[model samples]
Target chain A: MKKLLIALLVSTFSFSAMADGHAEWWKKAGAPYAGTVIQGVAENTPPGQFAGEVLAKDFEKLTGIKVQLENTSWDQMYDKAIKDMEANSGIYDFVYIEQDIVYSYLDRDFLVNITQSLKDQPELVAPMVNMDDFTTFIDYFKDGSGDVFGMPMEAFVKVYLYRKDLFGAADAKSGFQKKYGYPLAPATSFAQWRDNAEFFTGYCAEKGMECWGTTVQGHTGHPASTYEFLESIGPSFGLYNWGVTDDFHSCVEGGGSLNGARAKAALTFWTSMLEFAPPESLQSTWSEVASTFAAGRAAQGWVYGENAAWIASNEEKSVVVGNVGVMQPPTAPGVMTQAAAGEGYIGYFDGGAYGIPHSSKNKEATLLWLQYIAQSEVQADWAVAGARITHYSTYDDPKVAAMDQIADGYFTLMQNTGYLYAGAPMYPFHAAGRAAIDPFTYAALAGEMSPSDALDGACEALDKVMKDLGYQN
Target chain B: MNSSKTAWLLLSPTIVILIIVGLLPFLYVLYVGFFNWMPLGKNKEMEFINFGYNYRELVFDKFFIDSVWRSIRFAIVTLALELTLGFLLALSLLSSFPLKAFFRSVHTLPLVIAPIVVGAIFKLFLVQGLGPIPFLAKELFGFKLNYMSSEAQAFWTIVVMDVWHWTPFVTLTLLAGLSALPQDPYESAKIDGANNFQIFIYITIPMLVPVLIVVIFIRMMDSLKIVDEVWMLTAGGPGYSTRFTGIHIWKEVFEKRTYGYGSAMSVLYLYITIVICWILYSVMVSRGKANEDE
Candidate 1:
């Protein structure tokens, strides 16, 4: 009975204190929506898991609203969110909007305009939830007329991660120099990347180390293959957004350059890298690629920033905990200059936001939830947990700054060169376009089709789809 | 009159459910197959058009045709292997033997597991480097087997997993049929001084025709709808080499959200399945009737 009394006292004191701060504003503004149940659908990524399982608890405590965050796989997340919104079922109040799919969602008018929403109800906007604090990733979810449609939650870029220990070894460095007549370091160009892959793969084989030169996400039959090609590899080779032209044509007959010489060359180079990757490369996705590198079976690979922190610091899960290095992906001759000039992207800038669906029954409640997540104070803990941060202020936080050493300069690289980043194209038919390319890309990886042929086939299909969708004459 | 009215009342709920759940949605699918319906796009409402558009697009679609062919080929391969292996296992278990009941129980275990679970289990077992099966193959045979990577190997791997999981079901069905066979024909054949092999061929083979037909019919239907294993395993890739029609339709409907095209494909698939089933039934029945007459 004494313990129970203490628990009740603590709860009362905490609520009274919380009801005094910025949360006090929420406690007042959320008077009508309190105790209402709202739900969100999100993938099982680091940031998503933290938001769903951890932050949702704090959100309910602060606002007296119940939140159910359904954490699931990527496929199921998309299926459930899209199906519910399309059916106008009002099942989900908030949906995680991937950076790549922002175009599709905005084009469909499926998301509520948060800027307009906040304007209409100024009281609902908490002082701590300032939109100006977010990074430029917020632009990915904005309309042409400058209406903000979503709150940027997580933002990350793909980087070339290498084994510092292997590169720093005296013997390996001297041997690489002897064989390739260059210093062994992180690759700065595609040619150098290939050379390093070859040298390391052969060296590992000679030593019977069971390690490969690099890892590739070249799953022969999944959408990951298409993603790796269009987002990561093609951008480095100076072909962006599957090489679709401004008018959205993808074939020569339609006056587009999707199957142009540069694209074919990029596809060729990407497929060639598969030879030096592990045998599992043919069946590996991003998750497997990360695992392969973390297992110390690969010397270097382009892995998502989300995995960098855990792979570099978590000893129980990763073998090369301390010996990790990060850098921007290698670019072709003039591509780096263009990318640096902000004319194009050199690598994949991947992230997502949370937006309220128009079909949501609890729009006001969901808005409060979004605002709660948008606070800069909540960002530091989320960044530490997920290795993702969208608020520019979170970068200055001492705790987040300390993660640089463990993440091997991941944040530093992202800060220094993140402007030269890109993501999926602004296409409403994004999924359809990917479906058209995935088969041929997988076939190319499997050596069933030549790179040029695969590009030709993919573009031809895309052209037909574009015409069918009335994108072109 | 009271009894007839009671029977009508009893059937009304089932009729209502069928109309609500089954028939209505089916009609809706047919209606949506014409024109464009972008549920989440600027065109939130449906735009009606002539039916020729969806059909024309599908008719020339090489990808759709390839998926259909792949599904049929997988169905045929699985059916052939399951029938042969199932028949052999059933024949062997016909004789009284040690631990017969234990073997029977063990053989039925795979049938109890879900197809998706089987797929997930084999996905792990077939991982290129870390999987135990690949590790053992390398250690024992001095050769590598990358099942889920190579095109032919992945396709055959899925087939092998299915055969392993479902062949026991066929064996059980055949075993029950074999147990129920009459013994008078075999006795007369033995009394006429025919050898054991002749008696078995003339009596057992002729008597099991009806049971074999039933088993084949059931197996054909199930194997043709092979979606879960492939979806879990390769997802019809390395270049659509294993993409059956069902996966194609699923991607179209769910991933691409091309409901109009997907519904058209569904209708076409339904028609094709019905035609093929009818043909198979006619052939099998005619063959059985001819054998019985002979």
Candidate 2:
């Protein structure tokens, strides 16, 4: 009885001590800016929604600082933040700087260096916030002098997701083997991927099911289609940076491979897969493709990692819960070796970081808020809620380890093979480059032009845009 | 003060407001359009190129030129269809039957709804598998109705959406005009033993020309600058088939951040609109003068 009483008392004291530590830290660091209201804007993805809805409220309650985070669509978020920064309106205290656009933000000197800010004002720095706790993904948000600009909030790779129930079925295994002269499994090569797609499409049709072999993020209008091709599919075909050279040339005559044989082959392969995709493929963006897979309309597809946790576990939102499997995307010959050697990537590592804009009126308070979110204590829950991990320690959290099982080892694969994935190329003209190449991509998808003709036109357009931007003579 | 001074004083507030909100911004855009200015990037300073550089680029920019032509085409087709259907609707409403009030109320509902809402509604209605249009198409005719399947289908779908949205406004305008028409011409036609078609061609058509001109002018301008509904629906897709001038300029300014080029495009678009309106105004005045002379 004495031992039990002692144990209860000790546990109570420990819990209170932890709570007091957090309270005292906030009481000290956030006192001067207690009444300050910081505003931010981000794309309304899972992570962004979590930060806005959950973390903002928590931070306000603890620190007495109001955080008004606007979660908007991708286009509107970029437009609003960029316009605000350009006008120096100080409307937003912080903005979501996506991985691909950070280079441009750095070039324009739009973001405040967070590392320098914290160092220059040590009193505002929370003792618990340490930069070393973050994963290598933070490296993407650093400027040329290695000064950290944006604080890494969410990092994830686009991964291959397949319906395990369909692939593991006895009937499907025997049928696939008989038809393709191999054992049924997740695709490991482009030929195998096509065979699997064709077989499943036919098999499901014969079974009188409303299912397609794959989900294609091939929206003819949105930039998501261009991203899918250049970042996801093109890399798998041994093409990178849309086949543009480091010297800012994109056409074959300018010694670039954007219109080379490999690019044409990649385009053809991507377009041919449409036949095996759902009827909504032509209208499918990233979100639509995730929903299609969750609704059981697709058997396999490349899906953003943020949606993987829910699709594999959340029964209310996903019919494929407990039946989803994830793996690295199938790559062409030598691509895997190159990726292993850090020479190229096999797929897209897509995420974003929150950065304080130089025009922000409340930079110190915003820095504290960023540090609060970046604490190792909050990362595990954030990862589980958003299916994104930015801190290296988050991978070892007990909750995350448990979730890895439910997510079919998605987190584990990300941790193990993340080096093989890469973010968008370091280009200050990312949006311009994508815009120049997008119309041809849409035309090819809509059958208005052949793949060869589309790439040829796209390369020429890209070259012209680069030259006009003074990147080339 | 004298009566003329009072009149000018009353109009001064409105004129000042217009100058501040409209003319000033227009002037600024004109100034900006002469430079090569990108708000973001290392080379963001406003560099003055020649006055003709932007205009020359516009002439050779096949995408921009094609989008402008598409807008014109959309305006012509939609205006023609809306006017014909609206006239029919107005004539039918003139002689009411059962549930006429309900029909009128329902017809105006589309106009009352926001353009983005209309786009969202049609997008949900036409989506494959999830939407009812494709399901019904399959169930009723065994035909798969995928709007995003082809450029023509996507473009026509947008046209249909525009016609549905604005046709009611056109009907209401024409109805008001029809209600105000004089009875003398019709009585003269009936006394001369004229048929309905002949009377419509001669008396009604001649008398309604002014209202018809107004309706055409309004619809032409609105149709040519369409962005919201079409943006929400197709997003100028199925391979740039429906990329109108407004969408093109929006992409340039907002998406691509080519503010100078976008301003130039806007300037050109405004000039075109003004020229077109002037021609219509000239025709209306000349027609009125001829009638007055008679």
TM-score of each: 0.94, 0.97
Best by TM-score: 2
TM-score of chain B of each: 0.91, 0.94
Q: After superposition, how far is residue A67 of candidate 2 from its true place, in Å?
A: 1.2
Q: For candidate 2, write residues B1-294 as lDDT tens digits.
A: 999999999999999999999999999999888889875434778899989888789888889889988988899899889999999999999996999999999998999999999999999999877889889989999987777768888888999999999999999999999999999989988999999999887777668888888898999999989999988888888778988999989988876677788899999988887887788778877876676566
What fraction of the true interface contacts does model 2 reproduce?
0.53
Per-residue alpha-carbon lDDT of model 2 for A346-387, expressed as tens digits?
A: 999999999999999999899989988998878888888778
lDDT of each: 0.85, 0.89
Residue A297, candidate 1: Cα error in Å is 2.0
Docking class of 2: medium
TM-score of 2: 0.97
- Name the best candidate (by lDDT): 2
Model 2 ranges off by over 4 Å: A1-19, B40-42, B283-294
lDDT of 1 by residue, B1-294 (tens): 699999989999999999999999988888888858654334546787797788778888888888888888988999999999999999989988999999988988989998888888898888777678888988999867876456788788888998999999889889999999988887888889999888767777778888887887888778777888788888887687888899899987877677888888887887788777889889878877777787
